[model samples]
Target: MEKFEQIFKYVNEYAEKLVEANGLDYLEALLQTLEDTLDGTFEWQVEGANKEDMRKAIQIAILKGMRKSAQPNHQMTPDTLGLLVAHFVEQCFEHRLQHGPIAVVDPALGTGNLLFTVMNALNGNVEATGVEVDDLLIRLAAATGDLIEQPVTLFRQDALEKLLVDPVDAVICDLPVGYYPNEEVALDFELCASEGMSYAHHLFIEQSMNYTKDGGFAFFLIPANLFESEQAKQLHKFIKGHAWIQAVIQLPENLFASKAHEKSILILQKHSEHLKAPREVLLAKVPNMSNREALAMFFEKVSMWREGNDQKR
Candidate 1:
């Protein structure tokens, strides 16, 4: 752990230097520093470091840069939450893992942190795709993928815009919440608001499900009041028509600054004749993340649920 801290410190310092020297944004500077470090342009020697450790090192540096920037849209998914999502992915998609490499996409791929975290946890047996509109973020995501030697294809465009990529086995995203600005674009979506701006998160869910192969799963970190909003009735109807709700795991409220900001992981499987809805939705409230015994019990319940769910397939 000390060695990991040292690596993070080195990266953070170098990134800060670049930010000052080149008058660049912290995230851009951080990207350049990571690229330079990998190319031997930077003199940091990381001996006996595994890929996951190296990735975490970079992630920590990026987190600091994000704090310095303080942009709400630039928020990276917290590592704890990312790891939990990865665990759910591994458990739910165990059958796909047994067969071969699985393809995954993140529509709101900010900094690629959540996507890469899941990819690394899967031991790199993944075909990853990320969509982002920000130039710096897409570049950072691409560079981070190169540094980690993970093959990730990225698209630089509005995530809600028409995607050219093919459908994948699974979809994962920390859904970008708020109103989507393009009212014209929103009109094309089934979940578009009848009289006002549509929720981007709702539209993203629709878009994600569209790109997913039949019977594929989508794991989304959605707002806690997802079903309590004014547009939720339409959203609920759309979902019922298209997919099966597998689970809704409420994250610990303490993770956020306030109750209103709390989020939950919603797991949905696209509708297919071969796949039946789970006998019961796995609705759960996570305990404080520091409680190891509680967390263990929680996952044990997940394991038992998975076993029973598999029998239905």
Candidate 2:
């Protein structure tokens, strides 16, 4: 851990230097730093470091840069939450893993942190795709993938825009909440608000479902009050018509600054002839992550639910 801290500190300092010297934003500078590190220009003894260590070093550097930039939308998914999501993904797709590498996509791929975290947890058994509209973020994501030596294909466009990608086996996202601005584009979506700006998160769910292969899974980190929102009825109807709600795992509230900021993981599997909805949704409220015993029990419950559902199928 101490060694990783040293690596993070060096990377962060070098990125800061580039930000100052080139008058570039911290994210852009961080990308350049990662590129330099990868090409041996910024020389670090990372040859012997494992991929997880390298990923962590890059993540820490990105977090520091985000704090310096102070952009709310630039926030990366917290590592703890990302790891938990990865655990859920691994268990949900355990059957698929036995066959071969699975295709995965992150529509709101900010900095590629969540996607890469899962990729690392899965140990390279993923064909990864990332979609983002921000130029710097997409570039940073690409560089981060290259630095970590993960093969990630990235698309630079609005995630809601028509993607050339084929349906993938799994979808994962830290859903971008708030109203979607493009009303004209919103009109094409069934979840579009009847009289006002449509919730981007809702539309993203719909889009993700459309891009997922039948029987594939989507794991989303979403606002805790997602179903209590103004557009809940429409969103609920859409989800019911198209997918099976597998679980809704509320994250520990203390992880956020306030109750309103708390989020949950919503796991859904696209409808298919071979699959049916779980007998009961696995609704859970996670304990404070520091409580090892409580967390273990929580995951055990999840495992049992998964096993029971699998047997039914």
Candidate 3:
């Protein structure tokens, strides 16, 4: 094999080795079934050398692994997403991770990336609730919950609705957004931007702002456009009137499942008595167009922010 081919094979082998070490018996069983399926598919297609069949097998492996790995979100790279989420959640819940339990919520649970990552990071110090409008996603989240042997209370509700009234200790959401306004609303935000309202994604952030407990924190990943758009400006103007906007992390492009648009993660503290140092937006050019590395850079910065705050306190 060529050097590149050898490296690729090694990577795959190393991944399976890690899975073998970390996975439970149930996960092993599921992986076995998936392996059988892949073997059959590859054997059938090898005669004709059908590339599409190979792709299907890859998808099947991903789907099965996701289900077995307690992932509910389809088209998601759990390892990369989990690493990013767990990193930020650590910063957000470093204090609360000590207590018996705290309230955390993911408005757009998308296959439970934020939800499950938080669960793993906190090591179960938190009780979570997630809401997703997609039935397939809901089912996936439910299956992951079962696999993890935890109650990740999830609801089928629109994230763009008026209010979540009940306060939560932490909020993390990756609001869906596209280049066009209509695409943004229909995909993730789900609410129309009216005369008085700004835009759907921004609305999701604002509503989450209200749901976060006094002094609690919220982490949101929204399109970069939301920060520069006239709508975002007006919304920021309104937001400046209340709460502390701790920091904004501008992620590298293609950091999400879509791997197209660039987004930013904003940390907002709700009903807080104190204001932060007003951090300038941190910009990282995503070292290698890698979503995982980009997200890692994000929470690493967040950790720095938290440490600085701790020193001041």
Candidate 4:
């Protein structure tokens, strides 16, 4: 097993045990446990840190037992949001350690994972704001920001109805695939997810694009259905003519805690000369590891994507 794998195993075990032992929910215990066990060590502070030390840090988080990070009645936190957050952070770091945009937004930020993850990635540069209707999710997310000691703002508002007046530099999100949905078609989420016959899971992809600052990047974890077909072609035309489609990463089913194994990562930048839409979709097997491992692998892949077979637009 790899070094980070050991750490992740410890964290997961600790998280699960703590949740069961203390009768806390998974997301509630995560931030506090993570904060205690793993100090916010930047890339530079991690100089020459051996694998064993990394493993120990994870253990410490586990041994810390419990803290005040849990929230009551949080909704839609069934591990999907955690995985999405991990994926977004991977892309943020893969972008050469440079915070692409100041204002980062996620319209359907379930449990604030997307915002929190980007906050983790940007470390401070990216000002994140997430809009969710659930008050419980909002409170928990706010608590998570406090635990991480980073300000990840969350708003209890309808994303579809209210748009940010301020300009957005980059927008990253993982939209719902429409399992349980509202009736309003004009809702920003439905408008974005409408890909004809079965809504695309990561429908926020377009909303993120529409609001993203010019030349900023748009990264999303979505199904392969968005890759090909005439619908995809038309969408591609809309994006290609306006923005630079950075990379299309095809992932396995394990990428998220979903039944559908069909998955992929779509990277888009608003009009950039540095990146070009990939003609051949890059394939990647989803790591069967925990959410953290999946995220680590995703970030590692972002670095790989930057170096691998790519075209200059």
Q: Each prediction's Cα lDDT score? A: 0.89, 0.90, 0.58, 0.55
lDDT of 4: 0.55
lDDT of 1 by residue, 1-313 (tens): 5666768878888888998899988888888897897789986766776767777887888777778886778788988889989999999888779888889999999889999999989987789999999887888888888877889999999989899879998999999999999999889899989897999999999999999999999999999999999989999999999999999999998899998889999999999888778887899988888999999999999988887886256
User: Which digits, one per residue and each the tens of the lDDT, describe model 4 over residues 106-146?
Assistant: 77765555566556545566677777776555654565456
Off by over 4 Å in 1: 311-313
TM-score of each: 0.96, 0.96, 0.63, 0.57
Top candidate by lDDT: 2
Flag the better candidate by TM-score, 2 or 4: 2
Pairs of residues clashing in candidate 1: none
Candidate 3: deviation at residue 75, Å?
5.6
lDDT of 2 by residue, 21-65 (tens): 999888888888888987888977644677778778888888877
- Model 4, residue 181: what's the lDDT? 49
RMSD of 1: 1.4
**lDDT comparison, 1 vs 2, better candidate:** 2
* RMSD after CA superposition, every candidate: 1.4, 1.4, 10.6, 8.4
Candidate 2, superposed: residue stretches over 4 Å from native:
311-313
The Cα error of candidate 4 at residue 218, in Å, is 1.2
Q: Model 2 misses residue 101 by how many Å? A: 0.9
